[model samples]
Target: MATTGAVPMITLNNGVEIPQLGFGVFQIPPEDTKEATLVALREGYRHIDTAEMYGNEREVGEAVRESGIDRDKIFVTSKLNNGYHAPEAAAKAFEDTLSALDIGHLDLFLMHWPLTDGGYVDAWKAMEEMLQGGRVRAIGVSNFKQHHLNRLFAETTVVPAVNQIEIHPYLAQDDMRDFDREHQIATEAWSPIAQGKVLDDAVIERIARRTGKSPAQVVLRWHIQRGDIVFPKSVTPERVRDNFAIFDFELSDADMSDITALDRAERTGPDPDVFDYIPS
Candidate 1:
């Protein structure tokens, strides 16, 4: 279900239709984000993904505000930094995020990474409070595996609405996708193009050649056809627009299988399950 100019929405667990294909500015320099995000907006991307750790929420917000697009028409997602795991600290973190973005209510708020400090329960509780307070429209987890999600589910009745993870052909994560499907949680793909690693794959290249699309577009199209909400980040305005141009084409069944066959369990980002993250 490719969303044309119709905002390309995906129904979130909370009944919010998030754009299935969105723009991401991860790792973009903070100083360069405003112009980049504004370029994305002009290119017809209605959804934007950012994080407190990214240190560019203000720039994203500034770009959104300057775009002159109606607030209701755009969906923005931000994550809580690892340092704010305490329940009491969660509220402050959200407030800080809102202040940085200068937005009224968050479309989605997620735990950036499940830190080893064991503030997740407190963090979840704080997110619940914010949800109730109308500060965040929905709550979710990021980079969390089944164990972390299970731990959270065991403590809270409100299941996470979404799980944003590093997903691409190299790391398909079928188990995680199955878990989300059974639990009614939406799986969002970060680094949906495998950080461009799969571009040179023989299978991926074949599909791209057959489909008349770039390898990146072919991979992103595979993610979307596989029922994953993908946010592929690019700083170049032309690339940003080109990334969103996947809607016009569809991958055949053979193309889908060939792309899926490229899964190698390879992961590009840090594994949230085990990482000695020391906050700066």
Candidate 2:
């Protein structure tokens, strides 16, 4: 009874469906990523999220091929590197990502960060062009705030397919999620468990005991019940399997509320508006 069945799918604005729960390779090293990804795939994860910034897209791709799962059957997503925010660089980076992953095409591509310099506007335009060429099924933004999305709406032609942001029990991001919902953009929650920061919370622990699930499971279920796409990352096999088991259970309204109430605007990552680091 670990997993009830297949994971749920969230349809993007452009009609692409992404698995509600996936495996994320953010801090996972290149050497270890392939096996880690394979383990998650073996444990029933159909979606795998990697990025140029993550420096492990190739390993993720290797796992997909080695998993023996059809490319179309598995959903893959990557991002344009932060340094490659210019229109031309963004276009080139997209090709490099596809080449590095050696995947035929990407299910989703994102502007990894909305740098303060405003280059994302043109980079997004380039992504829209890439989408037209059929290299990427849908284009999106990650770590973007409300005003950043507003700028895109004012000047861009296509609405983003999804917004991947930092969301955990401590940072519910209700306003940002609401904005994405209003615009028909699906919200994907990265750092869903706050990088182990929330596992020790009293409320989350209490609920975990009541549900007979792990603390991470309770927090992840809270995100699912809130209707956000969540991908929890772990190199450990047992944790990876445990994370995907959330689909088998439900968190009552009161439980969901208790977790939601823990939100205090805490963020484990940098604030999107001013975080301008470009990976070297």
Tens-place lDDT digits, model 1, residues 177-242 = 999989989999998877788899988888888878899988888888888988888888778877
Error of 1 at 277 (Å): 1.3
- Mark the regions of model 1 whose C-alpha exceeds 4 Å error after superposition: 1-7
**TM-score for all predictions?**
0.96, 0.97
**Predicted model with the maximum TM-score:** 2
Report the alpha-carbon TM-score of model 2 versus the true structure. 0.97
Candidate 2 overall Cα lDDT vs. reference? 0.91
- Candidate 2 lDDT over residue span 210-233, tens digit each: 989999999988988898998889
Q: List the residue pairs that clash in candidate 1.
A: none
